[model samples]
Target: MPALEHVQPLEHRSGRTNVPGAHGFLGRLRRRRAQREHEASVICFANALRGMFRDACAGIGLCQYVSVAAGITVRTPRVAEVRLGPPTSFTVELMAGQEPADFTSKDRGPRLAHTLGAHGLRVEPVAGRWVRIHLLDADPLRDGFGLPSLAVATGAESVILGRTEDATTLGHAIADPAHLGVQGQNGSGKSAFCYGLLAQLAAAPDVLVTGSDITGLLLGRAWDGTAHRAHQVVGTQDIAAHAVLLEDLVAEMDRRLETIPPRRDTIRPSPATPIVLVVLEEFPGLLRAADALPKPKRGEGIPVGDRIRTAVLRLLSEGRKAAFRVLMLAQRFEATAVGGGYARDQFALRLSFRVPADSLEMLHGADARPLGQEHANAAPGVAYLSGLGRDCERIRVPYLGEYGEYVDRVQRFGRRAES
Candidate 1:
């Protein structure tokens, strides 16, 4: 990989790097200033944490007598460096057998943050008894870092979706045909995330993104490819037409599956045989449309509305091995919205953003409930990543700086399918 621009060059500062390359004396001065400030923040944060523990530890029944040195271990890097995403944080290693949930209990995050005299500090567990505390000084999710150019991501195997929050971390979703769901309320950056993910997928040579939306608010300009080459876009203009489109997409997916060599483990997308990612936007719109249909008659086939939903559920279940996947976006997610009591369970990955805590029910094994009105309602893109057998992670979608340009760029790369 190419060297990151944020990397401090050695030709300049002998002592340390301050931004990129301020030479010699000036670089050192800037470096020292940054280092001093970082060190001071670390000191203040540690002191405040220690004080908080003094009062809460004994009350919480923690084993104060368990180890030779029983206080929390503050593990923060001494190298004061600037990072591009979320603010860097420190971890507090508790005594053996003491897990993170012990101290990171509900409401304790705000309390500890207040004690340290900061807001927007994200506190969560990293491992057994190790609590990672992100002491954020600013809102990292407010803007975008430059995204991967179309040339860079096009034809590559996987797609970059977003970064994990406090999770100043980068994460990718493999096109090895993955099914992903995102649930969040308005102002939760839902549309922003779809664009970010779609832009990269659009760049990929082997991937084509087709989506359906009601308001067209999210997929508006982006899905407008040339008629001959445009990946289909399903509009809410006609509900019945939309339902039929869902069935058509499912049939298309089935054809892809049939072409896969039997017993093969996975289907890989390539330019010649591109894989399809069918995105369902503002999914509730589809649900409402589907739900409007009358129930099926006793001896007949599935109801028209029922078929649309069942098609989605089946697509998610059977499409993975066929190099086909679905990205479902919703303002609300729960059993009722998802077709059946067990249908929601089929989604391979689920992300929940700022909403009433109850919305977390959509994500299985979800522990961190949305902190409503907490931390000023968590940043717009801030959310939690959940899946079966995985620890939940807080994540944020990167901004797609220029929406129109991104759409145009995708159009340049994506063509209508022959399949």
Candidate 2:
């Protein structure tokens, strides 16, 4: 038998030898084949997504007869572009001339998501007649995320609430001084959200954090002996102390407003006069407790509840210029519960988490009624945020870990309070 001649490896122009499984001719061919397969698979997925979207629109009663304007384009693997068409006979009769608005409304978001059986969806109106449907492949907010370590030198002027559906951090601008309203049912992670927010605020040297908890659970252990703790954190049984806290806030607000220069519309916070964040947990219960207190026997006197309500309203209406921000947490934000519709409107930042229809509407207006039903079973810490110059969008509040870790973070980030 003739001995097999030894074959020298062929070297490609790029100096790579034709070794098996290396980036040579065979490897390039394999990569091209895989690329083609991936492209084909993506095309198939796009077609399927388009079909599902069309069927979803039909199921939601959005139809147009023989119109070129009605079509869905694949924007990405997870998003679809939809063009709005004139309403069909049924839609025209049902929505009259407002069918387009109804089609692109935020309220329709949940229904469209359900119809498509998507993980989560947000409908964003693109110029005239176009809307983008963002489909979440996996819920980014399903598992709570931890707070990012912020630079202490930067000084957190805004509190980082959580992450948005787009995986961007959602922050509430406290530096500009807008009152915030947070409402949710019990066990809705409302307290967790509060803790996260308070932790950030307490860490800011230019912020003075004071809070009252009707349950006495929120403000006690985590804040008691921390250097971040500023003013007294009133507890549940102290209805009179609640009144006193509000009154003191109002007095401070008045003092700041009086001292503001005529040329300036708002006060800038500093170590000398830090922004006052008055957090009232279970605010409605506090109001009720104040109302239950007996009237002064000396003469005609305002009930403690009325006094607290008046003080809160004054703060909401006039606090912005004075650098006093209120964060009111409650199960409901009805006009009566929050003093009135005017008071509710003053909260430029509103967050509703797993609340009832009435409560959602109270926070986001009547348009949010449909969303309330859609989010009736939203996960804890999931909430709708409104009044930041954008349509209300869903968000997930940051989880601060266990109680021990939360308290430790609070202490770690907290600055010593100025005398």
Candidate 3:
């Protein structure tokens, strides 16, 4: 959570020399050029220090086993060693924007365990273009303890994943499952964040997992070889298939309801079985299509805009007992987008990302008029997650390259349906 400060040059190897008389004329020009170059180098050095500090903070916050100290060691032009407790596997990592090819330096220590550093982390650059640095961990750096794949800590009823500077962003207890809702804009990392949640849920022994998406890409290859055996990527263009799938789900919901015992009115899903997560990407498409019908169910006195509203309300009222949870994604928020009080209350957690100026009223509240005007079009993967007591806070979700690997491995086991 520490911020970068101005770094003064500890030493400068290059300097301009003033010549007298004969070379004086040409010397002035040379001196000017040399001064510029020196200044540029000094800037690079200082900027590198800030980057190293940021990376060290990120590592300490992110890693389960690694604890980085405030100390930083600059070995050369682009090489830095961060002291985070005793060296273990990867005590030192190549900071982002620093390439091994930039300045060549070699060091010996423990055997290298991991060569490919965390990739896809976006960082701003003060000089040149933004770059991603690779993290390396070798034998010399290994501490006696092995790091856990994920280290989650729940304190003060708040959840802290990795390291975060913002206090209210992630440390709150997860609200009731039924009250969770998330909203985000395009490329805001909402999809990726959802994937991470799915992974975490899958790892839990008591939960079942089932998910479907209208767009074939949102779920993508993330669920390739995990515990999920049945996956549905419903295409919006195919209305017939889509309707059939919905009918089946309705029947499934009814079936689950019937299983509730008379004495014990509570409906419980078997822990071994996977629960269904109906992930609708841009669900408005389905609502619009349903409303196109001549005599669709509009609920009692509900207008035509009530199609989605009714559906959402139905899910909220009855879906929970059936072990069906809705994870809906939309690009925008509009009154006509989702119908009635049902749509309004169906999603308890709403997340917003780079939303349109006009949609703020529907997404955030009428009072968000000010924010809507100064809307910060957050970068891809950045979002504001609200709901379950985790109010809207700016966040950047990290992508675990493991998805690609999962896809490759699953495809090897069996061919994926191309169509």
Candidate 4:
């Protein structure tokens, strides 16, 4: 008999096929390699940013040392997020220790940007002893993005204007009824900003939108036939009509004031008594037009210009409690243009778009004077907003799409007046 062929089992006794453990081992190796590479890349980037920040602090005379604690996070290709160790003082010889506030001074912002090879930087203090820094290698607002969906609900007291440099939504409290002063040059995206704001105001059931535009350029088609259109927008070259409109608003404010309970400080808006937003477009032109009008006969009460100025001043001074708000737009907010410094001071919210240094200072004060040229050259819709208990911030107003789209949005969200 031939030797029996060595018989081999069809399956391995271990009940395992292929290369046991090879696949899992290889997978583990690959994961370990990938994690190492990622960590190495993070270290490399962190080191690079550390060097940039080191040099920047030195140039700015900040004796405080900064450390990258949270590592590097890339928000966009051009933007990076990092957390820095709280500024701590260093002493050399007999030098006194400096405070962290010295390192975070507003005056040092531009200098810090220059030293960091960055277009812009936001230094925000976070919890504990860390400062969050958003480093921008390029302007995030150089190009316009579509407006974010409105987060405010119908009858909400706030309105979303646009976004800040860090892409945070910027909103204003309309319920509190503070006046807004908007200053920008021609073709500076002011009209677009106004349209974006008006769309939201019109959507709110407890807010009534009324506007006066001497050039008729801003207050036209979008508001013409909507029930959301309250108080028939003044959209013509008639200065007399503008004055009358403002006077009527003052009268309405007075009526609302009387309805407030003695103990309550303000009138809470309801469908029956909504907050009235008076938008004055080409505000300076309105004043100039009024000035150009012939004086009334000796017995005619007050000149149209005086009536306009007085009504505006009264509204600015007394409208907040009565739920009356003003949004005044002008090329320049000179004392003469807005009825003097006293009147200008009443604007609780001030926004300056692309304008000259003098105009920026006029709107935001001397600190803004240094940024005039920067403002003048800013991209359309870029502006500096200050007031409402917040420090001045650079923001890009929302782009509500093309003219037709904007009008459509205005009409679609418009809340009809209650019957």
Candidate 5:
């Protein structure tokens, strides 16, 4: 009747239906099988990852995390990446009686990525989207808890550094003259951390502090000899002095190391602990100087540059045991700004404050994309840390004004002086 339908011509040799029931069923079966295969692959990869991780834990005293490079392959919906897709708690469960436990599910991924990258495989592909990361080598330093380490208060003794929510120092005391590292972009809390450190250390008994900032003005007020005698020289020094300063610091580090105290429990507060802390504001200054001249020309006429380089190398190689900690302060902590590789690696501890989207890598480690996701535009005094522990953590430092006042009153004169 609808000859009208003008079903014109079913132009097909085989009269075909728009929805082929049999073909659709066959396609569905194929998809289901593919999915099953993908799932199986993921399980196999995950197990492989678990085994690799166990091996890493055994080799390295510390626990480690593995990231499967899922992008290398395709994964079915049934297979999910066993990673912190968001800012999540990361943890790793270790094998039985491993002495040190492995990463629990509560640790974050970026931190895991940094630690593993140092001694593990990267961008490994698994079945579909899965990957099995094999982390090798281990850290020798054990945390106070004998597991994953915590960020202890890196402040001079008696300075009253506040504890972050994730870490509590109710009874814990930091080493005096704590080497501090502050990193952030322009307007980040680099200056703030510097100010806080100076003031806090000043409060400690008989503590001496000094620092230099190339791109800041706040240090002028807090460290101005005319106003504050905290011993900070503000404004950029001529390249000559800048070069010599590093050499002097190296000498200082050597001297300090010679003074390291034996691990003692006298509870009498050993005087061997250094009370002076030096903060280098804007660490790029040294890196820039070093890279400008070739090794031969570095100290050719002036020995200053060569000496500085040697000093830094020695400090990095031996400062930790000597107790001569260096505090590197910068607006950002990128490999380039910090002189990359050797120079950048010298500073083991790095603290990034509020920074721009592109600079998280400087503050954290190279694999900071995940941290960028969470703290791209975070406020000053807030930062994410890795290498400091088994997982990356977001931290908020307390703000401090009147650094000199804090030093004079709370630190030196006691709380009564503040009133």
Candidate 6:
């Protein structure tokens, strides 16, 4: 893939003049304070947006979509305001419903922005009877994105995967039991997302990392026992080797669930006990290998592939509360590879980094078959973040350096911290 120099800001906003001679000290200071307040306040709809949104919002059924607000205007929705953003992007607030979700539901939302002549869009709740509509002029990921230092990337909330197409908001990865599902065709930068994620993850204290690939190539090169790395990584095509690791994972899941306090939903990382992240590379191939083996019977030894599947399935079903999160990588998202719907649901966050039509459909939905073509051809790490429900938007995973370079940096950062 191509590397991008850090993300260049298109611009914050337009039409601000710096009066060098300004109104004297206090006057100038008051003007600056006003500027700051203006920046912080929500924007008003632009002139051009008035007509576009009026038509688009009505088309999306926002006017007709209303909630139980007793005689609420369910027939003729109005776009109350369009917050002016940068020249290319902005947000709109509609007279929606008591619950924004009612107006921005899957039935009404999925393709509203796409139909509104936007590169991407997101619908969010903004207090009562109001849902915010954000529109982007073009796909932000097409330009490619770069990662910050490990120190910056490790911060749970600020470490950006990439911003929305509009550049209005930054999306970051959450470590709180959001087991991720990453899918894309070969050479589509699926691994880029994984390794990039691992790089940021390594910075968090008490976060245990482990990864595996059938050929022992990618993870082997990136996470081998180095001066600064301490996680266990499995790199082999052998099913038996994978089986052993999976068995241990299942065992740990069982042990932890039994040991953790009853009320907690999942484990939180701390200085002592850490969050465990397991990455499965070429996961579908391994899954198929497991499914091919005959079912294990009483008094008969199970095949390594089957054993591996059992452990993986267990992790998917019951690992969250146990603090075991898995990032499954595969070229396909077929039933045989990713298990049935029940299993797939365990992955709260699903990402499709540059994938083909068939895989894209399976990962997102049938309608998404054509969605990721931009990432597959023009941009590498660009993908649709499917977990955002009806508001699923296109985002680019920031490309950290190649595996070795990233690991080296992680080590160097560790040394600096120690000193």
Clash counts per candidate, in order, are 6, 0, 23, 0, 24, 3
lDDT of each: 0.62, 0.70, 0.46, 0.72, 0.47, 0.62
lDDT of 1 by residue, 1-419 (tens): 12323556564456654545576566667667777897788677666655654554444455454334776744321222222234546566666665555544444544555554545566566665566666666554655555555433443444555665343555555564457888888878777777767766665556666656776645546555433235554566666666676778788777777777777766667766566677888777688876776777898876666777877777778877767677888877777776665666767788877766667644634345434345236667777676534566566666666667667655765454445
Relative to the true structure, candidate 5 reaches a TM of 0.50
Q: TM-score for every candidate vs. truth?
A: 0.69, 0.75, 0.50, 0.77, 0.50, 0.65
Best by lDDT: 4
Candidate 4 ranges beyond 4 A from true positions: 1-55, 64-104, 124-134, 148-152, 228-230, 417-419
Pull out the clashing pairs in model 6: 43-83, 45-82, 63-77
Alpha-carbon RMSD, candidate 1: 9.7
Per-residue error (Å), model 1, residue 146 = 5.0
lDDT of 3 by residue, 1-419 (tens): 01111222222223323324214355445555666897787667546644653454444332123335855543322323322212211122434544433211111100111122221121223345322232333221112211123312211122232212122234332323453445556666556555545443444333434434556554544555554435454555654454545446666777778877787754554443335666666666666765664564555443333434454556656777676777776666554654454565667667666676566546656545444543456555545554555434344444434455434433343222334
**lDDT by residue for model 4 (1-419), tens:** 11212323223345555744434556456546766897787667666766666666666766433455776422211123433322211111211453334443557767777676666665555444444555566776887867754634544556777687768887776886578999888988888888888877767767787757776645656775666455744544566888888899999989888888888999888867877888889888888888898998899778999999999899989998888888899888999998888989999899988898888887788777657777789888999999868778788888877888677776677766556
The ten-residue window of minimal lDDT in model 6 covers 1-10
Q: Which stretches of candidate 2 lie over 4 Å from their true place?
A: 1-52, 58-63, 67-107, 122-138, 149-156, 225-230, 298-300
lDDT of 3 at 329: 66
RMSD of every prediction: 9.7, 8.9, 16.9, 10.6, 16.1, 11.5
lDDT of 1 at 102: 50
* Model 3 / residue 239 / CA error / Å: 2.2
Q: Say which prediction, candidate 2 or candidate 5, comes out ahead on lDDT.
A: 2
The whole-model C-alpha lDDT of candidate 3 against the native structure comes to: 0.46
Off by over 4 Å in 3: 1-175, 203-208, 220-233, 261-265, 272-274, 288-312, 339-341, 366-370, 401-419
| lDDT minimum window of 10 residues, candidate 1 | 75-84
Q: Give candidate 4's error at residue 61 in angstroms.
A: 1.8
lDDT of 2 at 189: 83
How many Å off is the CA of 221 in candidate 5?
A: 5.3
